[model samples]
Target: MDADAAPRRVRADAERSTARILEAAEAVLAEDPTAPLERIADAAGLARATVHRRFSSRAALLDALAAQLAQRYVQGLAEARVDTAPPVDAMLRMTETAFALKLAHRFAVQLTASMTPEVQGGLDRLFARLREAGAITAPDPTWGRRVYLALLHEVNDLPADSPMLDGDDLAARAGLLVGTVLRALGGVWPPAR
Candidate 1:
């Protein structure tokens, strides 16, 4: 260690710049996946060159973001404490968590349109658990994938200028979708009195 050398200032600015860029990109993509890179850069208060330096290109940035989101969603599921709740409620909470806390609502919704099957690798286990718990039905090996896409799009019809979705809306729609799919697939929910 060379104590005699002047202490180097921390590179806080570079870290902040990169974080800003990613945050802006995520926000824009949530609202409009096709938003331009230059628009994201402007939102981040950085030059397009700076954004490119960090993300390299649009596709690279989008892929990395999706991969990052998948990992985060899985981690949230693993750490979720849903012991003994109504099976339907537990499943609903998990879906809402993915949308609200993960800021992955757009990722969750648009995945079908993009048809990126790989994200299923991270999510499949959670879907399996939901099915085993009787929150959903295992109509086919890939039935959860179909239900997930369907449930998300059902809510996607919300007006473009609606307020940010919250836990309540997430859970309500999730319950309806999962419940319907379960019955449709020949599974059952606790009967109404």
Candidate 2:
């Protein structure tokens, strides 16, 4: 039992360190894509060697960031509290949640601009699974994912240096994007769902 307990504690510490490294690297990347690993390590309060051990290489970290960003967007859509509104309004609020998550993880947000098919697949799978599980309701599971994918990547691509990024403005734009997508999806959304 003691042997098993020691390993469990070790695993927990490793999980915590991995989270710290991700947070530090993401903050650095948000400001400069070429930020040095040593700076990330310093911010994470870990040795550079530790970061290397966890991530292996620069490409590995970037890959994780992109994948994480896409998945987080889908998850936010599933989890946000936007009930009691028209379906269209709820959809818009969920879009707001996704954008908020992206801006919060600005490093990953950049890669989401050119979201890879693998990331898109994750989004699709999550939407389908959630719909089947009744965690979310969708008239068509594919349609739900398509709408989210458009809002996240295809449509409403913000400029890298867009001045229209103040908190309130960004959110308003997100609502517009959500409204547009819902209308396009054959969502009636007259005054309600």
Best by lDDT: 2
- Per-residue alpha-carbon lDDT of model 2 for 1-193, expressed as tens digits? 7779999998999889888988998998889889988989999999999999989999888787777776775565456433333344445666677667766886787674436564455445555554444445566656776777666653346664555443445565675565555455554323241
Which regions in candidate 2 have their CA more than 4 angstroms from the true location? 80-90, 112-171, 182-193
Residue pairs in steric clash, candidate 2?
none
lDDT of 2: 0.66
Candidates in order, TM-scores: namely 0.66, 0.66
Off by over 4 Å in 1: 1-13, 29-34, 81-89, 101-123, 130-141, 158-168, 190-193
lDDT of 2 at 2: 78
- What lDDT score is found at residue 23 in candidate 2? 90
